[model samples]
Target: MQSPQYLRNGEAPQQQQQRLPPHFHSTVSVQKLRRFNTLILVFRFASFCFCLSSSIFMFTNSRGSHFPNWKDFQAFRYVLAANAIVTLYSFAQMGISVWEILTGSTVLPETLQVWFDFGHDQIFAYMLLSANAAGTTIAWTLNGQDTCTASNAFCIQSYLSIAFGFAGFLFLGFCCLLSGFRVVCFIIYGFRFLVL
Candidate 1:
C-alpha cells in the first residue's frame, strides 16, 4: 500500500533504515574496560611494593655511633615518611580498583576518578622524587666525609632505599600517562566507560 506521493522519492523508507548499522553509537567495550582497569591495578601494586620496600630499608638502617638512628638526618627521615605516605595511598587506590571490578560499577563518578588519579599521582610522584633527591644528597655527603666503616654501610643502605624510591617514581609516571589518556578519552568521546 505505497502512496503515490512517497513513491515519487524512489524506494521505500524501510530499505533506507536497514542500510545503517544497528547499535553503532555504543562506544564502550566491556572487555577493553576491564583490561584498562586491570592495568591500573597492576601498576599501582608494583608502585606500592617499591614504596614499602624503600621505607623499610631506610627506616631500618642504623648510623651506628655516627648519629644513633635515621632520625639523626632530616633528609633520611623525609624519605621514610614520604615513602610511607605513598605506600598507603597506593594501597587505597588499589582497593578502589578491586571494588570496582567486584561490583562491576564505579563507586565515584567517572570524571572524578580521572582527575583524582592525575592529582594524587602527580602529588606522590613529586614527593617521592624530592625525598629521593634529598636523601641521595645526604648519603653522598656522608660518603664523601670518609666516615668509619659503620657509617659507610649506613650510607650504602640509604642509597639502596633511594633506588627503590626512584623506581616507584617511574611507575607513577606510567600511572599519570594512563590517567591523561582517560581524560583525553572523556573529552573526545564524551564518556568511554560503561555506567553501572
Candidate 2:
C-alpha cells in the first residue's frame, strides 16, 4: 500500500504514460486483414487450378480405341463432375477474396460471407475427397488388371487426374480451416474485433 510514483512526482498518470497514435491498432489490424485476404485468394486460386486440371485430364482421357475410357467408369465420371463443380466454386471464391483484399471489405455482409465460405469449403472439400477416393480405387483395380498393360496412357492420365483432385482437396482443406476459424471468431466477437 505504498503511495504511487506519479503522485510523488506531482504528475498525472495519463500525461506520464506513453500512448500510441489512435491509428496504430487500426493500421496493424488492416494490414493483418489484407494479408489474410491475400492468403485466401492464393488458396482459392490454387484449388481452382488443381480442379481445372483434374477435370481437363479426365475429359481428354479417351483414346477412341479398345482401351477403357474415363466415361467407361462411374467413379471416373464422378471425379470429373466433382472437380468441375469445385473449380467453378473456387473461381467464384477467388473473386470475392480479391474484392476483400482490394477494398478492405466484402461484397456480402461480413457475417454472411464468413459463414458462406465455411459451409461451401466443407462441402466442396468432402466432395472432392470422396470423388478422388473413388477414382483412385478404380484406377488401382484397373492397374492390377492385364488390360491396363495395353493402355499405359489411360492409366497414367487417370492417376494424374486423381492426383490433381487430391491436390485441390488439400487446398480446399486449408481454406476450410481458415474459414472455420473465421466463423468461430465471428460467432464470438460479432465482427467488431474480428480482423479476418
Name the best candidate (by lDDT): 2
Clashing pairs for predicted structure model 1, backbone only:
none
Per-residue lDDT tens digits of candidate 2, residues 52-151? 9999999999888677789889999999999999999999999998898888877888878888889999999999999999999999999988758988
Q: TM-score for every candidate vs. truth?
A: 0.80, 0.85
Q: 1-196 in candidate 1: lDDT tens per residue?
A: 9673433357566666566463243335666677788998888999999999999999898845645477888999999999999999999999988877666566688778777877889888999999999988888778767542446667778889999998988887788788778778777765634333
- Model 1 residue 133 lDDT? 96
Clashes of each: 0, 0
What does candidate 1 score on TM? Answer: 0.80
RMSD of each: 5.4, 6.4
Candidate 2 stretches with Cα past 4 Å from truth are: 1-25, 192-196
Clash pairs (backbone) in predicted model 2: none
Best by TM-score: 2
Candidate 1 segments exceeding 4 Å error? 1-28, 63-68, 192-196
